[model samples]
Target chain A: MKKPIIITAALCLTGVILMGVLSGKDVEPGIVAKLKAKYSVKHAPSADHAGFEALKKKFTSPRQVTEACISCHNKRHKEVMRSSHWNWEREEYVEGRGVVYLGKKNAINNFCVSTPGNEGSCAKCHIGYGLDARGKGYTDQNNVDCLICHDNSETYAKAPDKAGAPEAALDLNAIAQSVGRPKRTNCGVCHFFGGGGNNVKHGDLEKALFEPDRDLDVHMASSGSNLQCVDCHTTKEHNISGKIYSLASMNQERSSCEQCHTAAPHGDSVLNEHTLKVACQTCHIPSYAKANATKMSWDWSTAGKLKDGKPYIEEDSMGNHAYMSIKGSFVWQKNVKPDYVWFNGTASHYLRGDKIEDTEKPLVLNPLHGSYADEDSKIIPVKIHTGNQPYDPVNKILIQPKLFSEKKGEGAYWKDFNWEAASRAGMKAAGLPFSGKVGFIKTAMYWPLNHMVAPKEASVKCGECHARSGGRLAGLNDFYMPGRDYSAAVEFVGKWLLLLSLFGVLAHGAGRILSARKHRNGENK
Target chain B: MKNIKEVLIYSGFERFWHWAQAGLILFLAFTGFEIHGAYSFLGFGDAVRYHNIAAYLLIVLIAFAIFWHLTTGEWRQYIPTTKNIAAQLEYYVFGIFRNAPHPTKKTALCKLNPLQKLTYFSLKVFLLPATLASGLLYMFYRYPEGGTTGSLTIETLRTTAVIHTACAFALAAFLITHLYLITTGKTVTANLKAMLTGFEDLEGTECEPEAEK
Candidate 1:
């Protein structure tokens, strides 16, 4: 008895020790502290641009500021000239369609259509000044707007309809003097206010990220790591590393979380294993459009409605635009749960004149190319922005409506509410045929969530995606998930087997009790 | 209790192995089902961690048990035979109601009846091996980069998980019947006491068949 007791105690001790050994050790606090310290370290400018003689002059035009910038940083303009920002397109090898130059210049989006006839307003986000309808001035080195990205003053902003020109009231001299590495403000100014409003295009890239708290974004939080956009999107030769798949087609020069945090950053091996096929953002970004509501759907068919012969705007309870005479009736969502898809970096786009295959279903503007079988693919969170935009039903092609122009009767849809006239002028500009009749076709655009990453504690829990019902990955049913899926036949058979065994044992026990009583009664008789 | 003879049936090491294996299997099943998403008790991360740890311990326990059975020549005790199997089944199904005698008798060398022998044999040879193999595959499904776990890759965990889950159900059913069968001894806890203390009281000294094998 003593030996057995002692052996059991020893076994128990062994189990306790095994638990300690098997639960993997966390990363060393000292190492994490060191990494955090290094991550948050801010860069000090090498030279004071304020003392530079070239920047001390009054700049008459935004183009003169670019001239002043190039006077000293002469070779920098050449690098900027070769960038995708200046060219507005990149030579990409599409999977099925060989080589094609795809970007804002020719790529047709569901929102605002394309940039061909709307370059006056669309080019406000462009890096160069005076980008005309043909995307000219890209060849000129002085057109590179240096202060737009490098402005540390956080006051530089492009005018609404100035063809990528800075606001007229901006003191260009002060802005050029304060120029340094790009901050969150520089990127967020255009990226956050995409699709003509704040938090409209990319649901995750929004105004809240300008000075995010740790709970909103761990990396960019001013009270936390306080990282600048340039820290992660490490730029070289004016070519930023991060690629937005909505406009990008190639797999090259894409920024990834693995660049900073290695692929296996978790202490537990199970989570590290998940990293093999699950993108970090799938779990990290629990929801997007955290601070403000984002545009979810746009119905352009309802755009022509006017109140008392005036193009007026209607707002929802959340103060988001419910209907705007220029754009359309809108659907806005806050704290939006992102849909997920398999993405392998490469993508294909619906170019300017591509014919629609099916008119009933929403046409995918930019289809990310990946599947379960793709080794490089991983499940990523995405915002699928759907719209009912104009298309030529007879030509079987989506129309690129001329959306923005300063003057009326220019065939701009916003100014002149005639879809036929707008479609004709827009197609003529894009060199595509458009029928006189116009129809609204449903369309979808995928914007992969890459920012506004929640803190470690706020990340998606395992149960959220691993449960049987209402799982985040429930739509992705092609593959099997552990907790969420199982063979129905197996479950049915297994359940019956367990139930029968229990019932059989109970019946047997009861029979034994009755048999004993019967035997005792027989003896008494 | 008078005129009853005390005999040692289960050895100390055998009893120790039995209880240890039982404890580990129960723990594994609890954690395994949690991982299968039947319920969430320990949380997924901790459940996976504990399951892997317990599985490793079970493997080690099994290795030691096999060694012990081989060294002590107790391996032959589980060699199944069809002889008297019908009579044993009949006794349980019908004859036991009339307080009938057991068709096969227990002894120190051959303690298990024919039905026990067959059940335990199948558990050790087929069900236990399948469960353990599938569990190990599930654990080491995807190896890290540059890992030398060569030529053992699997495309998916679906088949392995199904096999594992099915085996768990079978084992759980077997456990329920085995527990109830323990009460079918001479007294309610006769077999239980025998397993715990390695000693049991028999009716008569002559009942201890020296020529049982």
Candidate 2:
């Protein structure tokens, strides 16, 4: 009885001590509540975060990022103001389907929103702060204010770190030594769009940026590299043309690869320059075969095949399906075989002196671009009859013409004999290089050629080009050669590799079945 | 064996041109891919630098290769033909599968299979030439004797870009096939050995004592 009483007393004492230590009397929650109420965040925040929120406070000056420019270059400001950039604000709120207006005063941005006091990161691209704090109806027209670019007015103020930049003329505190132009980052921020969703138009935003592993975005944001957005994205009227495709474009097909490769394994005049611009993937990708691939495969066991791994082919659709300009669901790169193909054939150079006689049928010699083999070439037309689209009789093109050539003969030429040349020629004349959109993808948009088979769910758009079942059945395993047998070579190659290692193990096992010497020598086949 | 004047497969300048060209191409491919983020090999910056260096070097090498091939009459070697190609093809497809005799026998005088001859011909004359010309067009989009942007048509440039990309893919596929084919030599290492030592260990009894290198 005495022990129990003593234990209870001890426990009570321990609890009292614990409660004293755990009490919130020292935390000052009241002050925290006030802070939470005011800033809607935790207390003791970094000054920067507080400053960012302070942007909502009423500002007396309209001359921060916008007004500063009006003092000198009012014309440019008015022009920019008329543009779509100012109409984009992120302050749009959607609560239980509140009256959603889609334009002018409340236009929902097609992509990103740029608003103040909103955590919308997109605002950084086109936002302009007047005094940080915005009042009741502070038209963000003040956003994307003029001083950001040509700071003739001192309204735009870059940070101290950017001191080297010339001060805006509108800035009342202008410094004399300012001459910073819009750098690539200022443009790419929205172009790469935080590096996803939408990249810079017409070109890859960070084409070849360095140190991809580390957080180089900071450097991208602030490095102020001498590189300008215009360096690669040469100016166009409304729409800028990439240097390669435009008349002003300068890259020479031959020189371009060599510029980086440092050598010409295939030699000059190796590729045809006429009827096309020289870009590598144009020939490499062939066409998009993803949707049309009959037997999508992960295992290379069947390098190219139908679902059952059978060397079969679908019969062409019967509805008098004329070869329309946009032949639906046709694959590219027909006449595929396992062992021998055009790549194994001869080699030749075509230019002023070493010219090839133009032919109708494409030669099916080994066509691996001369990476292997020790043979000179003979000219033969490479034949092809695969791709989602066929020649357009009206315009004589593989695809419908937009702004340029209008003759039906202006596109991919097809007689159902040879396609590679036709495809190359047509693509050269019609297909948009990297533009893979359906109508825009002048090149074939089938599969297993340019790209792998799209995921099962993604390949449902065959009707976009192909005729229901007929197109599927006709080209099922059209890839299989008519009369070539590659099974032996395949088995031979793999078995030979395996045989090398098995030799030793087999030697020991052979001793039990027969003489080791017999197994080693065997009957000379 | 009838004595053939050790006719140069490549000139001194040509060999230098060839190796330099090959080296730069490999380097460019490696670096360019890294830049594409296909697979990080060298760090991004290093890859870009390496790619740029190789690209410039390739330009130099290509110029030399063009000059060498032009001067040496070696360019004639790429003349394409369809002669006996049908038979040679049969051997690669059906006959090869049956272990039948190869229709196109290899000799110093006739070193390539019919199919090989045709392929090399097309690559040199068509595919690769197209690729090179387009590549140059891409590089010079920035600076040239009198370069300007917006000069090339988007249609033209886009087509060229695709062609270039396609050529790269073809080259990659060829590389893969070549790697596999290297193992198909008489003794697996036979072809590689020939390339390295400039001699091959003849297989079977067809080895005329005089043919032994």
Candidate 3:
């Protein structure tokens, strides 16, 4: 009795001691500590430098501000002139083909089709000035619109018809006086409002980033790190480091998390090992369009609808525009989970003159090139924007229809609602021969999502990738994952072993019990 | 008249460890299967929590059991020997029904037969340790993101899970056989009563307690 009491006391004492020790263990500092330490020290450039005080007042046009900026900066305009933003053309070496000129000016996108015959409205986002009706602005150094990027004042507004120039009555002197490092507002003016509306072109970028909550974007959170555009996209001599998805290249120095964070940012080496094959955004961002819904699909066949002699507009359950006679039918989605793809940071575009191989399938306007065999490739999250656009069936090439009018006499599709006239005017301006046979074809554009990183704790859980079904990587069979992958032979053998063991145990136990009962009966006799 | 006598076979601590370990293993197996998506009795989140708690409790029970075995000299009961091994097998398979006597005599110091000695030895030295180590590795695989704590660098938990589950099946097999064999003793309730009372009934007066080896 005494020994039993002692044993019970000992066991209880050990349990209590172990529990106390486990409960007293201290937790380690998390990733936020590392981020806070890294970005805490920064040197912000002074906005009010004495050099800008001597500039001439009463500027009548944006050109005057550019001339003043070049007077002191000297080589600023020359550098801007050499950039693709100034020329609106990028010389790219396509696989199997020689060097091809591709950019917003030459590339035919499904959204707004092309920029050739609609320069006045399309060039509203252009960094240069006076991009004529023919889409030519490369000749003048004074065309560098400095105030568009450098203006700290929020009042600087550009007129769409003025060809990237500020409004006529706007105070250019006050805009020039408030020149400073570019803010999110300045960059968002074009990027956020791309494709004719907010959150249309890029699902990851939106106006909400100006003062985003932590849940929307951890880096640009107003209550947290509050990183600016230029922080990761480090620039030198006015040349930005990052490139759009249409112009990505492995050889170029692209903006990546590795700019500030190391390759192995996580403390767990297991997760760090994933960095070599999986992109940081694949797990961190999880989803895109957190604050606002973005355009998912567009069907141009539904266009030309008119109600009461005017363009009809339809709204979805969320009050988002579902259909517009001017733009056709659209599907909008919010908190959209991006599709995964292996990207090598290099993209190839189908130029305006390129022949369509398969018109029956959706033409990949800009295809991201990578494969599982590529060592440089990583599984990246991308928003696939699908739409239908006009193409010349006889010429076997895509057509860029003039969507907006430069003047009253111009044959714009929006003004006249005539496809043939618009196609004729657009092809003539682009210096391309059109057979006048027009048809709408399906097209897809890939846009990489790299923003709206959730808090580290909210990253993808283990089961999201390891489960057998409904996992994020369920469709990604390029590589094998543990719990998600299985072998029939191994499973079969395991089941057999378990069943055999149970059978053996049952048979042996029955034999022993029967023998013992027989012996008891014999003893009784 | 048949002579009957009672001898203490299990100490209070030994009985306590045996029952506690059994309860913990059952709980661990139940929770572990739920986590493996074998069933949906407990949700995944709750299954993981319960599995972890049961694993820790099992570890604690094993620790106390090991200490007791070492201190009380009960570890010698599992040192397997080939002596009378064939006789024990033969008796279980055929002779017992013919009113044959047990090939090996039970004593306070040598409570287990040769077969029990081998099975218990393997369970303690191999399967139990394999399950415990694999479970611990899976549990501590992740670390605080910014901390310098060491963690397993494996990309997937498939290998660890396989090893843990295989050991669990082996243990379940052992428990089934053990429960059945307990009924093959002198009476159906005799073995269970001994575990509860720390005393076993023998039909002969010739039995004597063996000296420590």
Candidate 4:
């Protein structure tokens, strides 16, 4: 009777499992087509600029191309003028400091120091033309380089040292006529090559992302979604959304993965619950700098060590610059695991003239603020770039060393190779007093990784962060995590209790067996 | 041998509950320890999923068993007594080895000895409840987004986890001792057979009906 019951139970169990498997495989018709229709790039321009009478004229200067663009779009120059890209500074209410205008103008970084003294070379990436130390170019509507962002020709190149002017060799009239919506090439030109070279600044962004595969970037994959920057960084009146925390202070106008994929995107309830405290990129973007090496460290103090008194570059086995006499020694890495941190979007910057209080630990250039107890805080992955930059020992402030110059003997660190002269010139340009004593202070900059999101299958496994030893979240100990955390005392007592019980049971059983054998032997006798 | 006779010590339902609960507890322990990262056998995700399912099943089993015990008035079997408790302890500790007679006689009316009653009572009342409650809390507790100061919410999983893990160890120890004690019956497999078939050999005692009030 029990044999038939057991067999029936096993059969029922198998039937339930098979039903579950078959149901999981069930998909709605046209689901793949629907997803493709929602995500595929369809950014063809509404109007052809080549047919426009305004753009047909021969343009000499990029400013003339701006004029042609303005004649048609008329009021767009005003919108661009009011943008942070045009002004290079925005009014922000920092936590400790009250309302203050902060941007690349006043903010100091460990790489290329600050933009004050090197405006001519640095402004090549700036949207406007003819930017100077005085920043008077902000008032000039004609200085806005429209073709750099809108040109479909993809041939519009900026002059290396012409204060944000177009390259002399470029056909401005053709580029002006070919103008269309901005593409990945437009943004990657400057953003991908930040900190003087490719993949040197933002570890997650680089030239490799121009035509990424699905494995490298699910959203921007050329064969997949093919999403452009503006798809997610939607703009209104020239003010772009999605601010980088390295430069941004306020939490306003930020883009998130939740903007498209809702907060509870995961099918699993437990995984969905994790979204309350964990950012999507923390798991999705498991490793960054997948295709190219990114700069991890730069020791500026080691600069000026020329190989035979001439600025020369030294390359490692991977051909990445290991040392440059003009800059310093650098440490580059690829496929790096990001350090996790609690971030709440809002950040505070170490301004150009801000005094350094703690010299023992590396100064955080832009401190991303959040804690476990904070309401808006979530665990986010960040690429921390560490370096040693020159500072004023007596003034207790970081020095904005003059890093670029056209002519020699202008106190440019690259040209003159003199820290004292570079600090003096750079500080003078920034309107700060130099104490004439230059010191290198270790500094760290946190760049939150947001792009190059891998496919869901490539995301971090539960064991990676939930394991007891060497977990990915081992650094974050502010809160208790299951599997990774337990009471040591309870564990010790519990282990011993189980061990002693087993020992006692074994000993008692052995005694019983021995006594039983002796009784059997006595009966035999 | 004083006329050994067959007696019903456990009802069919009672035996079913015992073995089902035993299977569930062993399965729970295996999955629970895996989820605690003791050793990765069934993977962490599967371990957690199976553990939670087993927990819900165990809770249902407990409810049914509770209802059965109350309706049958079989709950009186666990009313611990000091009578013959020391003698029972002595028999197990030393007398069993010398081939001495048993201290407490097993009958249908009173199936458990004093020491077994005390151990079973404490386990059913305290250890099991504490383990289940703490496990439930650990599974359900989630910090409110943006923070909360409500009494229902806990700031961390530390307390719930420690209690659950400690109870797990104690229960594991109980399982080892219980398995060994089953062999100490009239025969090596007597208790096992009785639990399976609902009958055991009892000598010098009236083999009353198991349901007799």
* Candidate 4 clashing pairs, residues 3+ apart or interchain: A375-B146
| Model 4 Cα shift for residue A176 (angstroms) | 2.6
Give the residue spans of candidate 3 off by over 4 A.
A1-31, A37-44, A47-53, A91-101, A133-135, A267-269, A370-375, A431-433, A492-525, B1-36, B39-213
Q: How would the candidate models be sorted by lDDT, starting from the highest? A: 4, 1, 3, 2
Which candidate tops DockQ?
Answer: 1
Candidate 3 lDDT at B60 equals: 78
lDDT of model 1, residue B29: 87
- Local accuracy of candidate 1 as per-residue lDDT tens digits, A1-525: 547655794776587557746565643245457669898666778999999999898877778888988788879998888888888888888889999987788888877778999888888899988888876767777778888888999888888888888887888888888998788999889889988899989998888888889888888898988888888899888888999988888788989888877766776667777787899999999999898999999899999887887899999999999999988899999999999999899999888778888898889989998877787889999999999999999999989888888889999988888888899999999999987989999999999999988887889888888877788999987676778888898899988998999999899888988989989999999
Q: What is the lDDT of residue B92 in candidate 2?
A: 45
**Which structure is stronger by TM-score: 2 or 4?**
4
Query: Candidate 2 residues A1-525, lDDT tens each?
Result: 124333544553354335434431322345435433543322332233222322333334434424444444455555554443444321222223332322222221111111222212223344343322132223544454443443322334433212112223333323111213344444443444321222211122332232121122211222322223443344332123232110111212212222322222122121222102222322322223211212111111111233343333343343221222222222222112111122212122110111113223322111223221213211111222222222232233232212112233422221222233333343332232312222211221111121111221232221211222232212322122111112344334544554553553344334333542444456543
Top TM-score model: 1
What fraction of the native interface does candidate 3 get right in terms of contacts?
0.11
Interface RMSD of each: 2.6, 27.5, 6.4, 4.3
Candidate 3 per-residue lDDT, tens place, B28-140, comes to 77776666655556655445655676677778788999998899878978998887789999987777657577787776767788888988899999989998999887775
